[model samples]
Target chain A: MPRSATSSARPAGTAAPAHFDFDGIGTSWQIETPRELDPGTRRLVLDRVEEFDRTYSRFRADSLVTAVAERPGTHLFPPDSIGLFDLYDRLVAATDGAVDPLVGRELELLGYDASYRLRPAGAAERAAAEASGPAGWAADVERDGRRLTTERPVVIDVGAAGKGYLVDLVAELLRGRGYDEFLVDASGDLVHSGREPIRVALEHPLQPGTAIGVAEVADASLCASASNRRVWGDGLHHILDARTGSPAREVIATWVVAADTALADGLATALFFTGAHRLAETFHFSYVRMYADGRAERSRDFRGELFS
Target chain B: MNTRQKKLALATMTGLSISAALAGCATDTPSSADAETVAPSTSAAASSAASTPSPDASSDSGSADASSSTYADGDYSATGGYVSPNGPEEIDVSVTLAGDVITAVTVTPDATNPTAIQYQTQFADGIAEVVVGKDIDEISVSRVAGSSLTSGGFNEAIDAIKADAS
Candidate 1:
């Protein structure tokens, strides 16, 4: 594998990758630069995304989510999932289960089931759903070495940090294929390959076009979050709190940089609910926080290179 | 034909579109979501017009209008969620109207990871609800969870969303 300095600009002579369009994991997708990569390289990268989807997707029939939820006390390793169980174990110890995997069952009951396309539910329906489905990470799952069994038949939705990890994998594959300066951005859970830092504009969660801050990242993962972006009156939109099956509202938006995209992605979600003061001891990364009330906070470390 | 090929394509496109949209959404802020919501319905209606206009037409309009209303005044929310092909993890996000424009934001931390139970409910709502009625002009986000770095990125998005709304 060849590693080089990172640059936002595309290199000369390399064919721009082909762009592929499709849908999975409750969202539409498009791939660029597929044409540029060798056939074998392309195949491996694509396979990785599919495997993760199968293990994690609630909408899919054979997903590990369905397998685990439908069958308890069984060791089910997804043929191709993101190995989220592994990440969950890390988070459990890192944040002490502040963000648990077992909350899948409660999330489903809270009206966050797989069938939930991006449409809004009625107020009454939303209220009733929130009533019966409150869950916590404490009781749903028990894990052993590379194996996990759900204590109950709860839906496990992994729509938060999965893709970020995928980005890291694909970026790694690109390096293996001899591409040095590349960005493996899986819907903003992106990782860059190269020594030079890449400049990314941080979007204002509340205001779309305007950039509140900018960050320069080199060989690190960057992730962002925003609360006021998409929601309904019933307080139900995307980004469900597993504990309550509702949207999380602690911090408006969060951005994180870490050694890996997976950690950055998980930390982004964990920090969104964890709060800055609490984050002081738990997380080890550079960050910038924008509050719903217009107050912005940045870690002492994050301030060094992110801003001029 | 293979699922791998499709997923590869999906991942690539998703990455590209996110990059492009991030830049696009930045320039067109306020009305970007409106255009996003309206553009699809208009195209759908144009296609549907070729079909029968039945009792469902009104219903379709109602649903479209409800979602479309959200896009008005640049108070729009677009979620680009994805799950990796290697692990059982996923990311979901939505930007909503705070007060006049969009003043609130929320992020579900590792909705798949079973460890973040405590910060899920009130914290999620608190972040999102705080933006309920605020204008795009006045919005902010702080580190509220274990991952301040992540919260900072989210706050950056809120600023982008609000700037777009105006």
Candidate 2:
């Protein structure tokens, strides 16, 4: 479960932040604000989530993503999808295709299919899937504004930054409804908007209940990704280095703080394959990455404290 | 200050300690003749001394040379390159030495990609290992962001399969 606690550093006289907790998009969510949300606003948030899932979820048979998988043609996406696709494009370029969204077929071949098989395909089956799967995103898909065109079947899995984008969308909804100071936490992907900075602990990848460090985020987004979270086989995880169609072995976990949740989430995954410095060139963010060898590196500009 | 600045300050302090240690080592082997030979053209001596592959070469020379007790006094520089998972990366390392003691050290990042450059910059800035200390329970944080805890579906499927087997 995603952990949430009131900061011990809160002012003595200040009231505790109100939390609205629920489950959506297959993960737990908690929105922290100064006041409780009315029923109408809550319904709007849930509807938005349902709308996003219906469009992007590859696991759902009726989702637009499933339709894309069934056929090869130009599929229209919602206008808001521009942000998600744009981030994916930049991520693909930044990591040299190591973080491509078109790796859905590869994930399925590795037993992360729609049915949640959790069974690895045979070596030959994996090879055949790789050969038949969509070529590189650039070669396979074309985008004109919100329109996505592909000649061959492609499993458009926006799993990399979709949840973060949804968080952003929900945040926008809350803001539109006049909630200014709030923290929207979609699982571990968080977007905080308020005057006071919120201190967030960076969980240890090897140890579930312990934290490696803390980050102070105010009016920004913090996202973390770890390879151990979704493991099934001896050396299997959800984070795949698309270049090799295998789980990335270098970085075990990563945390990124950016202006937006989508970029932070995407970069968290990108950090598995690419170095933080490379990503910093194009995006303004601070990060902490833990390597498999037990070394943790954080940017100098990273806010908050890290225990040694 | 930025992380690089903090690291540089720490590196400077470490360098001072190293310098003091080397100074102590040099004093144990006070050789006037060796000092005179190295003082005038220390750069030339340092270049040749640095190129010598064997650490025991100073003892082989048979003279109580200052280079034997410590490095030759001068500025020394070297460029090192390595192939990372991303691609080949390189950096230039330069150090200033006085009386066989390193007075200063600097690393120039020569990476082509931004990621490599970032890593190189951090490396150049100097990396201090942050040992884990306080537990999560000890600190007060509003939230914790780590690995997403959403593998419930996968675990449920596994449980169902196990029940069938039983």
Candidate 3:
């Protein structure tokens, strides 16, 4: 439910934008628009979010993604998940498998399973989990029309890229409804639409209540990934490298800006391995990363001003 | 200074070792694939020079010098391969050029691994569709096989194609 609808007028020169906040997919969500959305439009946005939540959420046993785990063989894929698949396909190529979706099993074995509980698994449990799923499943996943045939029972997690993908989808829905100049912030994965650029603060990885930098964006999105938070049980956290099956240690935090929110999110994860500027020029995104040694690297043309 | 600015501006005041130096020499560096090799400033100049392709006729790192080719107007095919972490993966390319204008192109990636071949085949077919009607010198593929090794193999074949056309 929306915590509060801030329709209150602002300063004389500024436009009085409407603000919306809600919780879904286990995170806080917010929307800001220059004009208030009609009740029908609001319902449409929520319905789309719920639909995606049901289709992709592994936490829900009835969700389609969980069904992928429950069934080992080919299943008729969700009609709309094709876009998600394509985004992931491109991301895998772009990031050299750093942005893999097949990491779901790794997360589950680490006690980040459907229950959302935080407990590190024992050595035997990890070995058992490793036996159940393959580390790389994208190449094996076959998509023909509405059918997705998997060679093996793959527990792919879209969490790394799905949240940002959903954010873009919601932004598209809002734009389709003739709502211009809007901002969609889905638990810090943001897509800011509008002619006016928005200034965003980069969250410091080590220090609480501190920002590492400020970025400005117009008609684009910003996504960040850090290995510091979401910690539980002896250095285990949300971000897991498929290669190592542990938290990324090279870089502590990463921030990337891209035209698409999903792309930005995936690139941020990739930045952990490949420094922000060192990534191939093929990816047209700008980034700034804080390394484990506390050194910072920023792209030459990274879109905003450094805090200095 | 504000707390936020203080945290960010530290890159300037403190000797945080600005690692952006890799941005310059990394452009034509053949060792761009690995992320652990970014020690620069002292060794950046030496490593970058040592890694740069000599462009000598025998140099295998650089793609085929399109300029060396005598103007041709027929179909050209060449095979290129790159050794992946697993093993050697190769791709074959055929470009039908009508007086420097590409009419059609096709890529065939040959590999024993299922995923590697899949990406190579997909990229080969896709690259042909994209490069048709364009000059060979203008063909620049940023990504193809979801993996850099596959992309490298694809480029290797394209370089060989230029050599064949020449």
lDDT of 3 at A121: 74
lDDT of 3 at B152: 25
**Residue A259: error of model 3 in Å?**
0.6
lDDT, candidate 1, A1-308, per-residue tens: 33443443556785655554444343333444434556787677778778777777776788877887677776656533435557766665555555666555444544445554333555776577456454444455665555666655656665556767667667777778777755565445567556545566666665564456666677777877666544423555445555444567646777788878777777777765564434434456776665545645555456322221
True contacts kept of 1: 0.00
lDDT at B59 for candidate 2?
Answer: 32
TM-score of 3: 0.64
Candidate 3 docking quality: incorrect, acceptable, medium or high:
incorrect
Best by TM-score: 2
In candidate 1, residue A85 scores what lDDT? 57
TM-score of chain A of each: 0.79, 0.94, 0.90
lDDT of 2 by residue, A150-206 (tens): 888887778788889999999999999999989999888999987678889898888
Better of 1 and 3 by TM-score: 3
Local accuracy of candidate 3 as per-residue lDDT tens digits, A74-186:
78766667777887777676656766788887788777777645566789987886675556755767767557777666777887778788889889899899988788987
Look at candidate 1 and tell me the lDDT of residue B78: 33
lDDT of 1 by residue, B39-141 (tens): 1111111111112212222233333333434322222323333334433333222323321232322233344443333332222222221222222233332
